[model samples]
Target: MTAVRNVHERVIDAPAAAVGALLDRLSAADDPIFPTPAWPRMRLDRPLAVGADGGHGRIRYHVTAYEPGSRVRFDTPPGGGLDGYHELTVAPLGAERCRVRHVLECEVRGAGILQWGLVIRHLHDTMIEEIFDNIERAAAGGVARPVRWSPWVRLLHRLTWARPRAVGTPAEARLIRSSVDRPDYVDAYRVDLLPGLPRDPAAWTGVLRDAFPVLARDDGELLMDVNTAGLTARASILVDDRHVTLSTAVKTDSPRARAYWGVVKLVHPVMARTMLRRAHRALALAAPSAGERAQAQSPAPERS
Candidate 1:
């Protein structure tokens, strides 16, 4: 028997339970996003069940393992030469965000309808990609809202000093304060590519599929990370004034990190200049309110 594997990773704004529930729902339905034709019309019975116990071709496969908000596993038999497992893991990155990984592994038999390497490969890749794509759509509250952390849901976060551990010297304090902005408590950060042409998350996220060749070709993973943690970037309209504050307590004395920082210092000015130019272009297009314009033209406060 030949063996094959395919893996996909993504971060989403919804909770792990939400993603898992959607997957389970899809499995329960025959026409669950497998492209209409092959998706057996939804059967009234347990549609997702398949394998010896589930009634091969009826349910699809046997649920070998199931763990809520953690993982779910299933497999097919050897006769089909496509026995494999699907593992879904949810990692809480922020109070309301989760990182999801969907992985698949299968054994290819020497003789069977799906024995051909090319055919099996295509099936493994495309199907797995579809799984994540569907999950993303579902989690995004497509036509339906996914689970979310209410204000009552206490997220795990703690305040740390500007320095990681060791007390910062006077010089260090000045440098650290100059780069980072004060932390703001709110929903988690969501980092997705800047949407296409118009840069609108709503208008772009839908049509953005074409820009991603991996997804456009229907053969790739849509790795996404969602978090209410400060790490995420917001999905705001370009017209609004957006300010992103990046903060870190510098306690680590790691040699590697220091080395990288050393390199950054060399060209920081050039980078700043480039960013200013970009900002200028954006300001020109959006034209902030008069109040903002006045603030920008005002002189900076003298530092003590």
Candidate 2:
């Protein structure tokens, strides 16, 4: 088969060790559910074999290489019989950040086109598609570092994501009265929940309350008005049968908001909505109220 290259990378605001450990979960044979199970979704079910003792299976794989805080590799069954290899590398960039790269190659006679297509599709779905979600989860709990502004905040101590804003007083909230604002530390975040739950406003309100511990949830078209680190933020959750969208509004018109918007727009428009739905489903599974349980057992609404 014609050899092709597929490389993708994402900035994870996490130390290399943390990101590497997360990557190692990709081959946990005992728990196939780990590492997000991207391959199974793509119709490849055999577990990724880890260990230098290379053996054979439906999907043979070997951890050909590994560096403590850097790279990892896997050799997969080629053309369902021939030899093939896939490699993953993680590079740490000091500021609790990392860059990941995935490479795959195989040899097959008279099957060049099909092999190339499968590898391309697999890499896209597994690497480009799922890496963002993985990075967000990895960095969620890391302490926020003082954000580096885009050289235009006009003040030495004040670092804005993309705009100028005085970070000292709460009254400054009035200057930027919309969702976009000058955030103290701006990084992309992802929120995920269990699958299979009701996608409705009531169910979602509970999910937010649990996720952002300090954030409060109340009833209204005004979903949530959160108080955190002396800043007041607004968030709205819109839930439909198919998805839930969580819209957050911070009082600063900073570059952080822009970064969040940039990543969300590039990754997937429905990402937030899908995550909200997942959260709602998770809440239901964990502590189901009578009403929520009833809703879960009911048939899903027809997708119009």
Q: Which stretches of candidate 1 lie over 4 Å from their true place?
A: 29-60, 111-116, 141-304
Candidate 2 ranges beyond 4 A from true positions: 29-58, 78-82, 118-128, 141-304
lDDT of 2 by residue, 1-304 (tens): 4555556656666667766765654433322112222122111233333455343212456666666546667676455544577677778788666776666666655665664465434433443334444343443332133222222322311221111112222222222234445543321222322123344455566535445532333331224564444344555554433334455554434466545545544543244344544454345334532222223444223322
In model 1, the number of clashes is: 16
As for model 2, its CA RMSD to the true structure in angstroms is: 20.1
Which prediction has the highest lDDT against the true structure? 2
How many residue-pair clashes does candidate 2 contain? Answer: 12
Mind giving the per-residue lDDT tens digits that candidate 1 earns over 74-94?
666556556776666667676
- Whole-model alpha-carbon lDDT for candidate 1: 0.38
Model 2: lDDT to the true structure: 0.43
